[model samples]
Target: MPQVKGSKQYHMVVVPHRPVRRALIIVLLLVAAGAAVAASYYWGYHQGMTQQADAVAERDRLREEVSVLTRESEELRQQVANLRLGSEVDQQASDEMRKEVIKLEEQIAALEEDITFYRGLMAPGDNNTGLTIGALNVIGTDIPREYEYKLVVQQLATDHQVLSGYLNFNVVGRRGEQTETIPLHELSSQVDNEDIRLRFRYFQNIEGRLTLPEGFEPERIELMAQSTGSDRKTVEKKFGWLVQEL
Candidate 1:
């Protein structure tokens, strides 16, 4: 052989061709099935966790609402109790006020009695006949259209024998267009047989009631006394119409 610029070497090889694509496809299908099972398991676990979190949050929210409602109920109860206490206190105060009023009225009545006693001791009567009308109190009773009067008579000189006397009570008033005189015996139902007589040496108290007629109005009163001794003594007094009733 002539010298060639390049020498060529040849080697013989044998390869067997079979259907390996179907086997590869079967392997790929098994791998894909395993991956799908793992992904499904992960998704189910995540969904369960999310549902549990939502349930816990709802439970907490309901508990908070229950706590707030409980607090409000307690507050309402406290307010009601305070109102009841305040009402009790107010009632007690009102009762105390009523008691004070009653006590004050009693005190005022006692003061008035004391004033009358002192006045009788201080200023003597104007009658120079050794006899005096000390006090005249007109009081009202519980009976309707009825009045009571008190006359206190005092003797300055005990020198006389018990100054025996009787009182003549006369009421001077106006009727229609004319002047009228009313007698004490006519206005009272208890004036009979020496009932208006006084026989005390120092003093005498005369109390009696006077009931008016249907429409008779009284204005002034004249109280006259007649005493018998060696010389008959007479005294007259005038009093304004003053009476009280309950």
Candidate 2:
């Protein structure tokens, strides 16, 4: 060591070797990027949950609409069935009414016929008091060309005496463009005798069954009655051939 006279004093200070401020800035940027990514993920999850809820609601609404339509269709079917049944019942009722009306008409016609017959028996419209023809009727039978005939004779006198007579009848018709007349005895299957005798006080009904020949179209009937005993008289009558089928 060397000795110096009158020397000045010196101070010592330390400086940092690493860059700490730049490292702090880099760490702050990394934290900001991570926050942005977390925010985006949360938003997407919320949107997906809301869309699922909306789809579920739409499905329920569609199911309700389908159920309503099904109920309406069932009601319409029931109404149609009821209408058809009512129509059938109405048709049956109408048919029955028509049948009843027809039956009533037939009964009325029969009653009218009976009234006419009784009136004729009570009053005869002829001047001859000895013997007279009241009515004549022809009825058709089931057998072909066969018919039943009825002749009614009445007495117009008030004495009510017994009358005896014999009747002769003939059927006048056309056969193949030729005039033909058939006697009652020849045409009648039930009456074999030529003389039809009658004995009655007020009225007498002579009935017989007859059959016509083939191709014989009858037009009229002629009858002649002759009284026997004290009241000797002769009566002639003509009647048109009209057959009532039974």
Q: Which tens-of-lDDT digit does each residue in 1-246 have in candidate 2? A: 554667754567787766787788898899999999999999999987786676556445544554555555455445545555665788764665556555555554554555444443344456646687877999999999999998888665534456898888899999999999998989977777777888976678888799999999999999988888987888899999999989
- What do the candidate models score in CA lDDT, each in turn? 0.67, 0.75
Best prediction by lDDT: 2
Writing each residue's lDDT as its tens digit, candidate 1 over 113-225 gives 54444333333355544556666777878876588978887665413235677778777887776778888788877776433687865467887888876566778888877
Candidate 1: Cα lDDT at 174: 75
Candidate 2 local lDDT, residue 115: 47
lDDT minimum window of 10 residues, candidate 2 = 115-124
Model 2 lDDT, residue 69, Cα: 50
* Collision count for each candidate, in order: 2, 0
Winner by TM-score = 2
> Which residue runs of candidate 2 sit more than 4 Å off their true CA positions?
1-109, 112-116, 119-128
Tell me the lDDT of model 2 at 102.
Answer: 56
